[model samples]
Target chain A: MDQFLQLIVAGLATGAIYALAAIGFTLVWQTSQTINFAQGEFVMLPAILVLTAAHLGLPMGVAFIVGSVAFVLLFGFGFKRFLVEPMQRHGVLPLAIATMALSVLIKEAAKNGFSAEAQPFPSLVPDGSVSVLGAAVSVRDIAIFVVAIAAILGLQAFITHTRTGRTMQATAQNPTVARILGVPVERMILLTFLINAALALIASYLISPVYLAKFSNGETIGLAAFIAAIVGGFNQIRGALAGGFLIGLIDNLAAAYVSSAYRTAVPLVVLVVVILVKPEGLLGRKEERTV
Target chain B: MLFKTMAAAIALTAAMTVSAVAGTVKLIDVIELSGPGAPAGTNWKNGSDLAVAEINAKGGILGQQIELIHYDSQTNPGATRAAVQRAVDEDAYVVLGPIFSGPISASMQITQRAGVPQIVGGEAAAFTRQGNNYIFRTSLNQADSMPKLANYLRDEVKAKSVAVVWINNDFGKGGRDSMIPELQKRGIQVAADIATESGQADFAADAIKVKNANADAVFVYLNEEESARFLRAARQQGIAKPIIGETTLLGAKVIELAGEAANGVKGHVGLLVDAPKPTLVEFGKKYAAKYGFTSDHNGIKGYTAVYTVKAITERIGKLDREAFAKALHGARIDVAQEPGILIDTKWTATGDVDRESFLIEIVNGKPVVKATLPMINP
Candidate 1:
C-alpha cells in the first residue's frame, strides 16, 4: 500500500510538469493555428541557459531571470519573426516540418554551444520528504506539484477572465471575424507565443531539478506532452491539464507495477484505447480542422 | 605509352607508402570526440595523447615514429562506421576506439575486413564473441567482469537475494543479462529485475519498486549520469539496503554529481585511479596536470590501448597488422616486462582482456579501494 501510494504521488508530480508543457503547446495551437513542434525544445533552452549562467557565477535568481529573457528573445520572439512567420505562409505541413527541424537545431546547438554532459540543478525546497499518508514524498516533488497547480490556475484565469484572453479566444474561433471586430489578430498571436514561452520556461525550471539540464531531454518530455495534449483533447485548457496528469500517472504506475521495459509502451497503448473510444479526445470538442 | 604511365604511377605510390611506413607508422585513434559520448571519448583521446607523447619521448614504438591521428566518431553509429572506413582506407597500422558499445559494434567489422588490429574500450560481451580477430578490447567484457562482480556480492557482501535495476540499453542490458545468471550460480535469488530508460529523469517509481522488493542489496547497472541520478533518488527515498554497482557507478563523474548521496555506496571498479598502485597514481596525476581534470577508467583504457599497440609491435620487431592481431590473441603482458600496460594483463582467445580490478566504496566523494581481485586467468 505504501509503495502504491508512493508511485501515485510521484506520478502525479511528474504529470503536473507534463501538463504545464502541454498547456503551452495547446495555447500556441489555439492562438495562431500553429503547432510549435519544438515545444519540448522550447522548455529545454531556458533550463540549460539558466544552468549555464549559474555555472558562470551568477546568482540563481539573476540567472533564472537572465536565462528566461534571453530564451524568450531568441526562441520566442526571434523564432516567431524569422522562422515561424516566414514558414507559416507556406502551409501547416511546411510550418510543422520547420518546427521539427528547429527542434533538432536547438538540441544540437545546446550540445555544441554548451556541454553535452548532464548538469545537476539544485532543488527549490530543502532536501527532505514529508510522509503523505505513509508514503515518503520528496519536498521538491510536492513543491513542483503545488507550483504547477498555481501557475495553471493563474493561466486559466487569464485565458477565461481577462478581456484580452476572451479576445484571443475570439481570434482562435475565426481570425478574419476577430480582425473585423477590431481585434489585432497578429498582436494576439504574438502575445500567445510569449505566454506559451513563459509557461515553457516555468515547466523547464520545475523539471530540471528532477531531469537535470540535458540537451536531449526535451525529446521525451515533448513527446509525453504531445501525447497528453492529444489524450486530454487539444485546444482545451482543462483537457491538457487532465491529459498530462493521466499520462504521468499511467506511465509511472505501469513502470512500478508492470515491466519497466514497457513503461513507455503501456501509456501509448492506453492512448490508442482512448483514441478508439473517443477520436475527439476526452475533453475535446468537434471543430473544423484542416485535413 | 599507357602501360608506361601506369607503371610510373604505381612506382610513385610504392615510394610514398615506403616512406610513410619507414618514417612513421600511422595509427588512427577513431573515437567519440563530441555528442553524448564526448565525456568518455574526450577522456580516451586525452589518454592516448598522453601515451603517444610518452612513447615518442622513449624513441617511439620499435624506433619507428608513431603517427597517431585522432578521428571523431561524433557518438553516432553512422559516424563511427564512416570514421573506421576512413581509418582503414588510410592504411592504418591500428585503429583505436569509438568507446560506447553501439558505435563499436557498428564499425569494428570494417577494420576486421582490412585485417587491422582495432583496440576498443567497449565493454559489451557481444563485441568479443563476434569472431572478428582484428577486434580487441582495452577492458574486460561483460562476460569477464560480471562473474567477478557476482562473486564479490555473494562471498563478501553475502547477499542472499539481489535486486537488479538496470538501464534499458546495450551497456546496461548486457551487464544485467550477464550478471543475473552469475548471481544465480552462487545460489542467490533475484528479488526484482527492473529495467529503466537511458535518460530517465524521475526514478521515484523505480526507487519505490526497489524499496518494495526488500532485497538484500540493489545492483544498479547504468551509465555514469544515470547511476548518479539513481543514487540521489535512492538516498532521497531512504532505501537503506546496500547499493552495489560496477565501474560506471564508481566513476568520478557519478560521485561528483551524486555528492553526499554517493556516500557508503560500494562497487567493483575494473580500472580505478584511486587504486593503491604507484603506476595508476602517477598516471592519474600526469593526466590531471595535462588535461586539468582527473582521468577516469575510460582515460586509462585509452592510454593503455596505445601502449598495448606499442608492446605488440615491439614484440613482432616490425609494424605488422595481421601478426599483431595474432600475437594479441591469448597473449599475456606482465607489468614487470612492460610497465606501460600498467596492469599485468592477459587476453583470451576471443580478444577480451583480463586484469586485476578493485572493489571500492565511495567515501566523501572519492572511491576508496577496499579489495583487489586478481585476474581469473592470472
Candidate 2:
C-alpha cells in the first residue's frame, strides 16, 4: 500500500540517523572499552555550534566545516585527553561516569550559551517532496538516507583498506598486544574518538533540519542510539548499524500500524528482548578469557 | 511603678501593630526561569514585573507597596516543590505560577497544604478538578477552549472528517479528550487518533498515518517546538490537508522555527500582538519597549494575573488568604493590564477564567486573526 511505502521511506530516513549515532557509540566502545554515554551530546553540540556560527555571520558551508572541526578538537580530543585518559587508569566505571558527566556539561552549556528555544537549522537539500514508487518522500529525507549510507560505506572501506584503520582495529582487539606489536594504541584511541565525533556531527547536520536544533534533543537522539548499539552488538559497528535501522523501522511501523502511544516503548521492548535472549547481542562474539 | 510598666507594654504593642500595617505585601512567583522552559518563563516574569511596576507607580495596593519574589522552578517538579515551600516559609501573601501543568500540579499539594493562594496560567483541566480551594487558574482551560476549536472546525473550516494528533501529556490529552467528543457531537468523524511523545522530532510516521487516513483536516495539540517540527514534517511529506492546531502553534517560536511551512495552518490563539484593540496595542508596545521583545500569550496571562490579584487584594483591603480565595472564587473584574485579550476576567467556582479565544491563521510568517470565539461553558 502507498501508506506502507510512505512509512518505510520515513523509517529508512530515521534509521539512517540512528545508524550514525550508534556508530559513534560503537566506535568509541570498541577502541577504548568504554561506552561514551555522551555520544548523543556530540550529535547536538556541532549542530548548535554551526547554528551559532551561522548566526554570527559565517557562511553556512564554512560554519559547518569549522563547527565540526572545532568541536572534534575541543570536545572529542579534549574529553579523551582530559577526562577519559585520566579516569581510564582508575577503572571503566569512572570513565563511563565521566562521559555521563560530560554529556550533562555539554547539554547545560548549550542551554545557557544558546537560546533554549529550538532554532531552525538549514537543510543540506532543497525543501520539496518527490513521488517515489507512489509514496511522497521529502528531498531532505532522501539526501539524509543517501549521505548516511555513503558515510557508512566509506567507513567500511577505510577500515578494510587503510593501514591506519587496520592498526586502529588491531588496537581495539587487544590494546596491550597491539602496543607490544608497535601499534600506537594511545593515538588509535584518540583517532577513534575523533571519528566518533565526526560521525556525530554528520548525523546532526542531517537530522537537525528536521528536528530543529535544540539542546534537549541530545537526550532523545542519544538514548535511541545507545539502545541501538546495545541491541545490535555494542562491540560491532555493522551490528550497530543494523540495530539502528531496526529500531528506526520498528518505531515508525509501530506508530503507523499499532498505537502511537506505545511507539516510544518499542525500542525499550527490543532492548529487553535482546538482553534476555542474548546477552552478547545478535552479532556480538562471546569473550573468551583465560584465567 | 505598675502604671509605668503598663504604659511601656502598651507602647510596645502599639509599635508592633504600626509596623505590621506599614509592611510591604510580598507575592511569591514559583515559575521556570531557566532550562528549556526559560523563554516562556522569562516572558511571564516580565509581564508580572511590568504589572507590579505599573501598580506601584499609580499607588500601592491598599496603600502598601507590593513586592514580588521570584523563585526559579528550573522546569523540575522537585525544584517547584522546593520553591513552593520557600514561598510558604517567606510568608508570601499569594503565589503566582509554575507555568507548565506538571510542575503546577506537583506544587499544588504544597500550596494547598500551606493554604497559600496559588494562581497559575497552565491549561491542564486537571489543575482545577483537584478539589483544592486555594488553586486558581487564570488561563483558559481545555474544557472551555477545545469545544470552541471543534466548533470552528465544523462551522468555519467546514471539515467533516478530522484526524487528531496530540502530544501525550496532560495539556495535549485534555485537548484531545475534549475535542473528540465535541467533533462527534457535530457529526464530524474522527478518522485517526494519534498520540505523540512530547518533544518528538520525527513525525514522518505520524504524518504518513494521517495522510493515509485522508481526513479533511488535521488537529494538532503540541507544544511550540513539537508543533513546528510536525508542521514542517507534514508539509514536507506533501500532506496538504487543512491543519488546525492549539494555541501553542500560533506562538512566535513556531513561526521562527517552521518558517514558510507554517503558512495556511489555523489555530486558536489566546493573545495576538496585532489585535486591533487600542488597549492591547498600547500594552504590546509598552511590553516590547520594556522587555526588548514581543510578548506572547503567557506574558498576557502573567500580566492579567497580577491585576486579578490586585483586584482581589483591593476588594478585601488586606492580605488574608482565606478572604482572598473567597473573593476570587466567582468574582469578575475587568482586567486593565491587557484589556482586549483578557477583558472580562470572570472566574468560575473552579477558578477558570471566562476569557474569549481567537482563531488565527499563519500568513507571511505572522498570525492573522480570523475569528473570535466567545467563551462557552463545556
Candidate 3:
C-alpha cells in the first residue's frame, strides 16, 4: 500500500507536467484553428534562454525576465504575424506543417547556438520530500500539481467571466462574426498565442528541474502533450488538463505493474482505443445535428 | 659545362620540394560533436588534440608532421558512416572515433574494407566481436568489465540479489546484457530489471519500483546525464542500497550533476583521472592546465589511442596500413616504450584491449580508487 501510494503520487506529478504542456498546445489550436507543432520547442526556448543569460553573468530573476520578453516577442507576436498568418491562407494543414518546420529549425539552432549538454535547472520549489500517506512525495511534485489545477481553474474563470477572454473565444468560434461584432479578431488570436508562450515558459521552468534542460527535450514532452491535447479534446481547456493527468497516471501505473519497456505502449493503446470508440475524445464536445 | 651545371641545380630544387611536401601524415577523426554524444565527444576531441600537439612538439610521429582532421558524426550512425567514408576518400592513415557503440559499429566496416586502422572508444561487448580486424578499442569493453563488476558485487558487497536499471540503447543494453549472466555466474539473484529510454525525464516510477524490489544493490547502466537523474531520484526516494555502475555512472559529469546524490556509489572505472598511477596523475594535471575542465575517461581514451598508433608505427618500423594492422594483432605497448600509453596495454587479434582498470567509489564528488585490477591477459 505504501509503494502503491508512492507510484500514484509520482504518476499524478508526471501528469501535472503533461497537463501544463497540453494547455499551451491546445490554446494555440483553439484560437488559430492550427496546431503549433513547435509547441514543445517553445517550452525548451525559455530554459535555454535563462541558461544563456546566467552564463553571461545575469541574476536568475533578471535572466528569467529577459527570457520572458524574448519568448513573447519571438514566439507569440512574431510567430502569429509572420509564420501562422502567412501559412493560414493556404490551409490549417500548411500552418501545422510550418510549425513543424519551425520546430526542426529551433531544435538545430538550440543545439548549435547553445550547448547540447544537459544542465540541472534552478527549481522554483524547494528541494525536499513531503510524506503523503507514507509515500515521501517530492515537494516539487506538489507544487506542479497545484499549479496545474490552478491553471485549469483560472482558465474556467477567465473564459466565462472576463471580457477579453470572451472576445478571444468569440474569435475562435467564428472570426467573421467576431469581427462584424466590432471585435479585434487578429488581436485576440495574438493574445491566445501570447498565452501559449506564457504557458510554455511556465512548463519549462517547472519540468526542467525534474527532467534536466537540453536541446532534444522537446520531442518527448512535445509529443506527450500533443497526444494529451488530442485525448482531452482540442476544443476544451479543461479536457486538455484532464487528458494530461490521464496520460501521466496511465504511464506510471503501466510502468509500475507491467514491463517498463512496454510502459509507453499502454498509453498509446489507450489513445488508440479512445480514438476508435469516442472519436470526440472522452471529454470532447460532439457536434449537434440540429443545423 | 654551364648547361650541365644549370640542369643539376634544377634537379636539386625539385628534390627539395618533394621532401618538403611528402613530410606529412594525415589522420581523420570522426567524432560526435553536435548531438547527444557532444559531452563525451568534446572531451575525446580535446584529448586527441592535446596528444597531437605533444607529438608534434617532440619532432612529430616517425619524423612526419601529424595532420589531424576532424569530422562530426552528429551522434548518428548514418552520419558516422558518411564521416568514415569521407575519411577514407581523403586517404587518411587512420580514423580516430565515433565513440558510441552504434556509430562505431556503423563506421568500423568502412575502415575494415578500406584497410585503414580505426581506433574507437566504444565499450559495448559486441564491439570487437564482428570480425572487423582493423578496428581497435582504447578501453575495456563490457565483456571484460562486467566480470570484474560482478566479482565486486559478490566479494565486496556480498549481495545476493541485485536489480539492474538500464537504458535501452546500444551502450546501456550491452552493459545490462553482459551483467545479467555474470551475476548468475557468481550466484547473485537478478532482481527487478528495468529498461529506460535515452533522455527520459521522469524516474519516480523507476525509483519506486527499484525500492519496492528490495534488492541488496542496484546496477544503473545509463549515459552520464540520465545516471545523474536516476541518482537524484533514488536518493530522493530514500533508496539506501549500494548502487553500482560502470565508468559512465561514476564519471565527472555524472558526479557534477548528481551532486550530493552521487556520494558512495560504487563502480568499475575503466579509464578515469584518479587511477593512482603517476602517469595518469601527470596527464590529468596537464589536461586541466590545457583545457580548464577535468578530463573524463573519454579524454584518457582519446589521449592513449594516439600514442598507441605512434608506438605501433614505431615498432613496425614503417607506416604501411596493412603492416600496422598486422603488427597490432598481438601487440603490447608498455609505458617504458611510450610514456603516453600511460599503462601497459595489450591488443588481441580481434582488436580488444586489455589493461589495468580501477574499482572506485564516489566520495564527496570525487572518484576515490579502492583497488587496481591488473590486466587480465597479464
Best candidate, TM-score-wise?
3
The alpha-carbon lDDT assigned to residue A153 of candidate 3 equals 75
Q: What DockQ class does candidate 3 belong to?
A: medium
B260-302 in candidate 2: lDDT tens per residue? 8899999887665766556666777889999777787778768
Error of 3 at B190 (Å): 1.4
lDDT of 3 by residue, B62-110 (tens): 7987888999998899999999999988777888997899899877889
Candidate 3 TM-score over all chains jointly: 0.92
Record all residue pairs in model 3 with backbone atoms less than 3 Å apart, i.e. clashing. Answer: none
Tens digit of lDDT per residue, candidate 2, span A1-291? 988887887888888999999998888878767888888888988899998888789999999888888998987798789988899889788899999998899998898898666789987688778998877877777888899999999998888799999998898899999999999889888988888877888899899999988888888789888888888898898988988898888889998888777877988999999999988777877766665
What TM-score, computed on C-alpha atoms, does each candidate reach? 0.91, 0.91, 0.92
Best by DockQ: 2
lDDT of 3 by residue, A1-291 (tens): 878888877778878778878888778877777788898898888898888888789999999889888988999899989998888899889899999999999988888888777877787877667788766776767788888677667877887799998998899888899999999988899988888887888888878877778888898788888788889887778878888999998888887888667777888888898889987777878745442
- Give one digit per residue, the lDDT tens place, for model 1 in A124-222: 766556788977777777788899999999988987999998988888888999999999988888887788888888889888776778898898789
- Order of candidate numbers by DockQ, starting with the best: 2, 3, 1
DockQ of 1: 0.47
Which stretches in model 3 have alpha-carbon errors above 4 Å?
A287-291, B1-22
Candidates 1 and 2 compared: the better one by DockQ is 2
